[model samples]
Target: MKLTESNALARVAAYCSKAERCEYDVRKKLLGWELTEEEQQRIIERLRKEKFLDERRFVQSFVKDKIRFNKWGKAKISFELRKKKIPADIINECLGELDESELDESLRKILETKNKSIKAQNDYERKTKLIRFALSRGFSMDQVLKTLTGIIGNTDEEYF
Candidate 1:
């Protein structure tokens, strides 16, 4: 069923009102509805004017949710936001606002939980597994290493 312009606009507006949405998300929805480029543009403009669509707000909400709920690192969050067509500058500014200590704490907790489940023959293997897990979750090697040191202890042992 093809939706007329006004119906599409109302549906999109209601969608945006339910939760924050970026332009890319709205554009995708409009495109799926098979609206013409001009119609998509006009609807987008109206959404912006009425404050139903806001990229910055979307980015901020995304960052907060990803950090708190997903326990994701900066690299993963930044990559996801970029994928959503958010501006790099906005991503940087929002990520920069995160507390370094808080991020470290989040990493620490994640490693602690993971450490309990990992079974290894030796400390080296355990450390290796932990590092790989954290890295896969988008954490930097440096931060993972630092946090692991405190959790795993035995810092003198060489782990490659």
Candidate 2:
């Protein structure tokens, strides 16, 4: 059944309070609730003015959580945020806010994980697989290649 506008607002408020959310996600939810575009915009404006919806804040929190808890690199997190319609300036700002040391560590850990999963391959094949995996995870080619080289150069052990 189609809910009244007030009911939808209350429900969305309850949903958003549980976690940080992006405007794109909230828009999708409003559509799911069968709200008209005009009504959706009205509620969104109200939310924005009241500080319930802040794009910059959402991008910042989203990037932090994805990196910290999910171990995602900036490329991956940035892509997701872009898909949410966040501005490039804000996206760049949040990415710039990421610690370089933490980013390097996250890349190293992902490389290690990929290495473990593809241990039976030859050197050429191994590198190919690792690069592909990291690419799929949205890591940059240069970072993946450099780290892969470093890891392989330091290891004398054969693949499993």
Candidate 3:
């Protein structure tokens, strides 16, 4: 059904209320409805004024959900938030909420589980594969190396 301005506003408001929404997300939805630029801007302003849309809130929720449910590392989470057009300061602020020790522990768990499933010719190959896997999951090389060192008990091994 074609949505009138008022109806579109109501629908967008409901959509925003159902979850945290950034301005970009709301604007995209408005555009999908074929609203004019003026109408889109007005609706966006209304949503912001009514507290139905908040970029910071969206960032926080998005970060928390991705970390807790998806087990995503900071790098991956930051990349996804950037893709959503969240500001860098806001992304940093949201990412700051993640505890360092918790993140390390989570990475440790992931590596341990992955190590068990992987079969390689030698310890060198295994360590190399583990590092590659962690890196692919968006963890920094430094963190992955440190975590591997702690888990594997020797950093001197060439495969690190």
lDDT of each: 0.90, 0.79, 0.86
Error of 3 at 139 (Å): 1.4
Off by over 4 Å in 3: none
Tell me how far the alpha carbon of residue 125 in candidate 3 is from the true structure, in angstroms, after superposition: 1.5
List, residue by residue over 47-110, the lDDT tens digit for candidate 3. Answer: 8899998898888888778766776789999998888888899999878887888778878989
Q: Which scores higher on TM-score, 2 or 3?
A: 3
Model 3 residue 13 CA deviation in Å: 1.3
User: lDDT tens string, model 1, 133-153?
Assistant: 998777899899889879977
Q: Supply the TM-score for candidate 1.
A: 0.95
Clashes of 1: 0
Clashing residue pairs found in predicted model 2: none
Output the number of the TM-score-best candidate.
1
* Poorly placed runs, candidate 2 (over 4 Å): 154-160
For residue 123, give model 2's deviation from the true position in Å. Answer: 1.0
Q: Regarding lDDT, does 1 or 2 come out ahead?
A: 1
Q: Which ten residues in a row have the lowest lDDT in candidate 2?
A: 151-160
